[model samples]
Target: MYMNTLRKRSFQIYADHIRPYKGRVFLSWIFLLFAQIIGLVPPLLYKRFVNILSSGTSMDTDISMLVRIILLVVVVYIVMNICYRIAEYVVVHYVARIMADLNQTCFAYLHRHSHQFFSNNFAGALVKKVNRFVNSFRVLFDSFYWDLHGVVVRIIVATCVLAFLNIWLGVILFVWSILFIFVAFLFIKKKLVWDVQKADQDSVVTGVLADTIANETNVKFFVGSSREYARFETETRTQQYLQERSWMVNYWLNVAQGVLLLLVEFCMMYYAVQLWRQGLLTIGDFVLIQSYMFAIIAHVWDVSHIMRRLYEGFADAEEMAEIFETPHEIVDVKRATTLVVPRGEIVFDDVSFQYHATRTIIEQFNLTILPGQRVALVGHSGAGKSTIVKLLLRSHDVTAGKLMIDNQKISHVTLESLWQHVSYVPQDPILFHRTLMENIRYGKPDATDEEVMEAARLAHAHEFIESFPEKYDTYVGERGVKLSGGERQRVAIARAILKNSPILILDEATSSLDSESERLIQDALQNLMKKKTVIVVAHRLSTVMSMDRILVIEEGKIVEDGSHKQLLRKKNGFYKKLWNIQAGTFIM
Candidate 1:
């Protein structure tokens, strides 16, 4: 059953990824087989040396023949060594190329997965899985070339030589090969269970370390440093225990394998001695039997060890397989075309959505914003406001109804083309660990340095950026940790400005700024918003009141929708209550 599973999975990988590597695969096998065949020559040559030495004692000219024989052996070994080196060079180069191809495919498949997949898994763990997947294929391929090809060649050569000497000796050799391999398999099966446990424990330790470091600032602020340390220590100890247990199992298997090798050697030699005593075999035949047994034992070790490692490697590959197994949750239809939204109009036709059996976040919700209009969505936390933004971006598809831009159904358009027309500034504004210039240029990779600076100036970021010694070239730390909250928002705004998409969504983009910074950024935003359809999500009433339309949503429904002054006419309206709290006075 285990072999069946391994074959099935290995075949699937070969069918999908390995088929593209035809040239490399053929070269690797040819080089490996040629090297192994040449390697078989030395053992047979050793028989000649043993036969000569045993008989040369009484012959007068034996000394001259011995020198000649030694020289011949040296030349053979030198040629074999050269071939082995060439073979190794080609195999290494091709192995790296194949692994690289698989690595790239894994990354492409993983990135295409839905937002929920990323939200559920840890970043560090996913990276580690891809790394392990590629690395395992490398190991498994090496084992196949060296152990499978090399060992099988060695065994076949030994068998043919033995049978040529005597059929009974060949029969004994073949039986010993089967018994030894069967014993190794039994022990390897036991060790594989431990290997799986160790792998699981390793992933846990890695996850804990990454989560702890990523949240280190929170740990310090909440005074939970000691608590986090204790948690990590417990996980580390468990991982260590699993590793020790796994190694112990492997050690016992090696001991059993050594015992089998000894038995095969003793029996083969004893039988050869009996044949010599009965005059059924010559002295050279006896020597040949001894040399072949040693060669077979060496190969047996390689084959068994490689098979064991292949099992472990396949186990690692299985984890990455799970990630690949999930089909893309949101995929464009056949013949999907690029969205052409010249008017920048958005409409949600009776849209509804829920997250995994949870209460509906938005039910039968409908809204429309005309071309180039400015709109604001105001609501409390968990009021499905962010969900609406994500739906617009097609990060998550609506559970019901259609979302359209210029009459093009969002699901029917290519994702890249759809996103190309929209510029989004997330609430926290994630930034890459790169230079300020590079981070801003990410929105428009081809944008010149001058253009980047122009966008920064419009977003009110150029003033602070110029203060740094490096100016635009300054490096922002991981996730923009080197920059302050307001500074990161400005960089994000500058990126959006560079993109200059037809539609813009700003989700609490200015919530982090102080009163003075807010006023300055609002002025910049006004310039960026011109002639573009803009959707703003804000908690502060100041940002919402200036919009042409305000939407008040609660309990998965739009409770009120109108201009700020018109909505405030109702004394008990949700929008009026929020406006009064922010300004500290009711508007007439």
Candidate 2:
């Protein structure tokens, strides 16, 4: 039942993509039918030529007629080839366009899924699915047009021609062809199960390899290369096993088909001989039966393989079809309006959130930040500080209650519009494998190069960036592994500074910097924060000392809210204790 559903889904995906080009597809099919019909004429002409030659006339006496027959055969073949080429050209041209569209469509749909969906699936697996989905379309279409469609047309034409010449011969070919296809389909049904399994295992192998490569540094640091190798070997071995099992099924199917074809060939030829001896069949009839028999047998043999290719294509496409069918976890509301954050005021009214229903992270959390206020959230690790920031960014929607920005509900606005007004610098910054200039300019795509350099100067990132031989053009390795932790953070800070959005979020953004770098960045941030509403999630007590207000959070709830000086005056308060520990001036 599941396989049946998947088959429908796979074809539907193909249909949707091809619907716009249906006219071209219909035209291609017309050309293909004409080509197949043209291909059948040569076999009939051969039978006629053989009968003429056997009419007891000397070669010299019938030389002109023989020459005419040969010339006609050659003309028929040339026309057949021309039609085949035209059909092929048309099919390939449209299939290429369709495949490219499918690739882009798959990528666009996959990206629309919420953050949670990405968290659950491996990136490598997702990439493989997209490639397979696109490539499988090509495989299935070619098989249908060149192999399956051609074979069907050939069989129908050959059967009709033979039945016209000899009814018994046509009946024998038609019934045997049906039996051959029916048996092949039964094998295909069983092989399809293995094909789907093999496809899934292939994805697993790819995911395992990607995961290992992505974490190559970790494996090297811990000297766990052997362990990773063993893990990868296990996955590959399973893949090999599934591949072999699938191939074995195909092998057995060919064996069964071969036996069927041999029996039919013997029965038909023996019957043809008996009719010839009884004067019921002409020598021409014998030649036609043999020629058509061989043609049908060859085409029938291809049916098993074509069925296998079709099902294999379906198996590959089904994986991505499932992803397309999954609804996006986050979507804009109907008639969603743009988020205009002129004041940058944020309000979290009676908000609550949980990754899972069994364990709540934040419960009934309520807070409001006035426009242009520099509010700091200080808490121990896992105290929901980052969660609060993510909520404000709408990375995950609130489980309950309303989160608004400048009087407009965040959920009521388009996600792109909401994100446009905010600049976020995460604790661990990830950079694309591109030039530093490109990475920095990501904050404001249309920013002038001069503006980018100025932003880098403000974030104190210009010194190291200029030292590289390539300067701003130096490529950052994957995830910016080429840069130190401090350098990546500075680049991230520079990006945020260049953005100059109405609201800024720094979740331990300065944590990775050295003391001197941090001091310089603090100075830069002060200027950047002049009129923007700033929310800082910091563990370091010294960073929040100058904030307008500091909220101490513990276990997902606000434990204290006051200025840094006021919080320090409370001798045993959570903020005060944190301050004392960081300052190394414990009161105990």
Global lDDT of each candidate: 0.84, 0.90
Cα deviation of 121, candidate 2, in Å: 1.0
Kindly give the stretch of ten consecutive residues in candidate 1 with the minimal lDDT sum. 2-11
Task: Flag clash pairs in model 2.
Answer: none
lDDT of residue 52 for candidate 1: 76
- lDDT tens digits by residue: candidate 2, 149-188: 8888978998898788678878888899999999999989
- Top model number, TM-score: 2
**Model 2, which residues run further than 4 Å from truth?**
58-61, 584-588
Write the residue-wise lDDT of candidate 1 on 84-167 in tens digits. Answer: 777777777767777888888888889888788888888888888888888888777777766777777877878887988888
Taking all chains together, each candidate's TM-score versus the true structure is 0.94, 0.96
* Candidate 1 C-alpha error for residue 526, in Å: 0.6
